[model samples]
Target: MFNQRSSPDKLMRIGNILITPLLVIMAVVGCTPQPRSVDVTTNPTPTKLVPDMRATTTVIPPTETLTPLPPITLDARVAEIEALMTTYEQMDLFSGAVLVAEGGEIIYEKAIGYANREWSILNTLDTRFRVASLSKQFTKILVLQLVEEGKLSLNGTIDLYLPDYTGPGADQITIDHLLKHRSGIVGEPAVQNLERIERDYYTQEKMLELISGFELLFEPGTQWTYSNFGYYLLGVNIERVSGRTYADLMQERICVPAGLTDTFPEVTSDIIERRASGYWFDAERGFIHDSPLDMSFVFGYGHLISTVRDLYLFDIALREGKLLNSSNTNAIYEAEFRPIGDETCEAYVVEDGPASINGFRASSHSYIREDRFVVIVENVRSGGYYLPGVFEVGRNIAAILYGCPYDQPPPHVGD
Candidate 1:
């Protein structure tokens, strides 16, 4: 079924919507021989230099106030969401797009805030946003496709795919372990714990070496530890087994067949169309430019860029069993899922959900017992205040849109 319309403010409630959340992701990817971390630290530049953009919103004097968005409707719930987003926008907590659909019909769609703050360019419905950790779900589907094709096995050890791998967990971590996060392979403490690694540059070779040397946090399969490096290794193995690149796999295996055009692996050098500039907020300074990242560190797990529409296609693909058999497609929920909000709210549990990176945040989930879909991609990060993540935002939207249970969000006080 085709979806409906989008607006910057005051969107129409065209019809009932699906209550599931669709994911968002960002960045490019790199693949190694097998089970190796890879990414070409995003070109020669240390940070992305956003080229000047021309759009509906023209240049505004840096010191001048921005023109106010005209409100579209008197719909109360829609107004609540619009108000919530506006508050977030003023607070520099969110800047991107949202889409909600029910029964395969578009119920609500809107873009909020700036895509390129320097240019005063408004984020449109089609603006591309990095899905970040949301890429893992996409990766999981690809892996299952291979498993379905008998090209890979869920229980296959890393060494089975990457004979070159000799790390301590190489033989111990199975594809299943990686998928379920039972690999015990946490990221390097120095890298993972860094508060600002987004500003640091890392080479593909260096990232690989670091992961190869990491000691497992515990025995594989006996523990469930989310590992980006484990997903990175899966990317390597995805390439090694299929004898294809990640982009190729995405284009052929998923995008082409599923009718997803604006979705693909992020490449550092390519100038993507309708791409949004990443941003971070500072309480004293307001919106700050999102720093450039040049690390191959996020290869498979985090380096994907997409739009709400294309991601909706992806969600539909999985739900309709277009990507895999019914048995395997259900694997999306087979992993460990932590509940969405605290005791005061009722929302779906999420598994390996995305955490914000530099300029992007996202939330995608399904099955709220209402056949609804709630997808939001926020292209800015919060630096000054504790911002409710897109996941929390999605939960609130779901409550309003599909009559799901939720309460007003508690303040996230930041240091």
Candidate 2:
């Protein structure tokens, strides 16, 4: 059974097959895919892809006559994913970037739509967008690295490292609780509901002061509420314990070693080249300009800005166990994630995880078992709620890649 409430374990639960790691990353996190020849960093660009549209009656455009697929090489299964993208972009459902890799090679990648609509700039492979809670994975790695270095203990309380933190559950909250979001640090009702926060400029000191005043929602480790404040404290703890700035530690520990050039903490004051403008999509009013958030507001929870290529390199490095010792690398997979949905196929099952913030949604879904996966990061999202987001796109993409069943969206109206 796919038990969402079960204790976190090392079990690799696919639709039906539960298996072991590596050799078995062949399944990634779902079903096994027939082996294909590919590996990390191998990108082959084909000038033209004959679209292999499937799912609910696909229509070939009137202008282009369908060439008979070469019998020698049937249309690539990945093309179905491209067809899906065309459908999404036509519907104004997705805009940003996507990269897909399998058997260790990048099979497909593309940048779609406008990066900055005002200037009419197009999104490119190198475009940088705020990654939101995806930053937590780096925080998780840093915390685990500290454990490996004997500088911190997962079971240890936050008070051990940062003595000045006077939050409600400083003594009761374990570092483990914080990492898992089991920390009970509840923000003010207004912050929790995200009212007028986008317009406020928060400095690090002021943000910490705000966190200091937070009260716990429940006893530590007894429940989960996805506390950004808990993660902010972890960042503060990392700085306090390592005596290095978060940016310095990240660049030294993860980016430099992983050969990641474009991944870094966000700085609102600096002009970040190729940074994409985020927008809110309103069906009735069209695209509304997304408000700028203080870098401090994002803080430890979602502060990093990166591109698809850099995100892929980081995934390759981490899964190859280059980022941490074997134990911690495996821990990344085993660590509990707030379950995505009741049925497994409905979610991307990101090895690092999936997240959204304002105008952006990011997912790093890997078939570690099949050595296959999809990475999606986009700008422009509905202001009302989450959904019609990348999670749906990635799930369908994975299904196409693995030959699993998935519904391809029908063509958009009047296109």
Candidate 3:
């Protein structure tokens, strides 16, 4: 049965899955003062426990009159990004692809580093990488589509759809709770012991069985917790109600209609062209192969793979109401602003960006009101040779586009 109230300790456990060790590094390093020039190719490496030199130094005045810089045009913005990316490449902090768009047209697009590092195969705009939790947005859209069609109800309980399932608070957990990650279900259990179980493929039934046996972390709707289990179950509910598999339904409803050729459920065994090989970094071992997992285990939660261009199409489609009506689309954005786990939702949320997994990280910004968007997808992990923080990479690009003050990535010591 669902608990009516949540304990403080339980509420504190709602950690965001998207936050990676790299973000921790950034938090500790903190932000530096923005430089006068945009050239980031020569920024000094960060050092630990540096004394406050700013307090001790005397101010100096220039003899000549300072000239104010000219306003940057759209073409200049593209060139600035290219220069920034070149600096990142030299620093060994970035690899993969980036695409920026405005008013439904691509303004700038570029690819850096190798897709298959072993073969030295260069990454291109077509190089597909796992979008990780960005897949959740797609899943959310599918569920909303069903709601619009009257095939599913947002307030409907899990038991109403999957009566045979016996998860805790099955009757009390509503579709809204699952979509918002307030269902109290735990998801990290499936990720643990990956080394032992990843070799074998898991069917939806097998994954569900594993998730259902676990007790609720908190009562449904009492507290927000990001749960892969919640989304997976929602996927199952979609399957049960629509009488179709998650993949088939996504194809028929979302992908086909949007003309998303590159976006689809990842099938590990099948030969996928232009798929970037995943890589992770270790202090002791340097860049290492990302541990493999059966794609089936990540169904509806994270399995979709795509390129930047395909994702851009998705953004445009959503903005133009190709998938859902204007009312439903607005509702989706409203739901997005409702707090997720411990994090407070942004007041004027304009984008859904940043999805990180083991070896790959993806982020896209659709400034719908501003009529501009940015997409950055990296195939390298942080703490590697020169890889920058994933969130920082996205932030820098956005700053450049908006002509806001921005700091270059602090140099990693080893690099």
Worst window of 10 by summed lDDT in candidate 1? 36-45
lDDT of 3 by residue, 1-415 (tens): 0112223322211121122111113312322222221212111222212122111111122223323234777777777777777776665557778877654556677787778878877788789998887888899899999998998998999889977568789999999999999999897654678666755798777877778888898988999877887888877888888898888998888888767889998888989999998888665675678777677777788888998878877766666677887777766544212111121111112445457666788877654434566778878775524456555566566656555434565564443
Candidate 3 scores a C-alpha RMSD against the true structure in Å of 13.1
Could you report the Cα RMSD, in angstroms, for every candidate shown? 15.2, 11.9, 13.1
TM-score of each: 0.74, 0.78, 0.78
lDDT of each: 0.64, 0.67, 0.67
Number of clashes found in candidate 2: 16
lDDT tens per residue, model 1, 1-415: 0112222122211122223332223222221111211111111111211111111111211232323223433255566666566555554445678776554555566787777878777888878988888888878888999999999988888888876565688878899998887998876354664546544555545556667776789999997766888888888788889998888998888887668888887777688898888888665666677677643557888888888878777776666677778777654644221233221223332233445556888877553233456688887786645556777677667656534334443333341
- Please state the error at residue 181 of candidate 1 in Å: 0.9
Q: Say what the RMSD of model 1 is.
A: 15.2
Report how far off residue 161 is in candidate 3 (Å): 1.4
lDDT of 2 by residue, 81-181 (tens): 66777665555556788888765566778777778888878788888987887898888888889989999999999888877777788888999998888
**Which rank order by TM-score, best down to worst?**
2, 3, 1
- Which 10 successive residues of model 3 have the least lDDT summed? 50-59
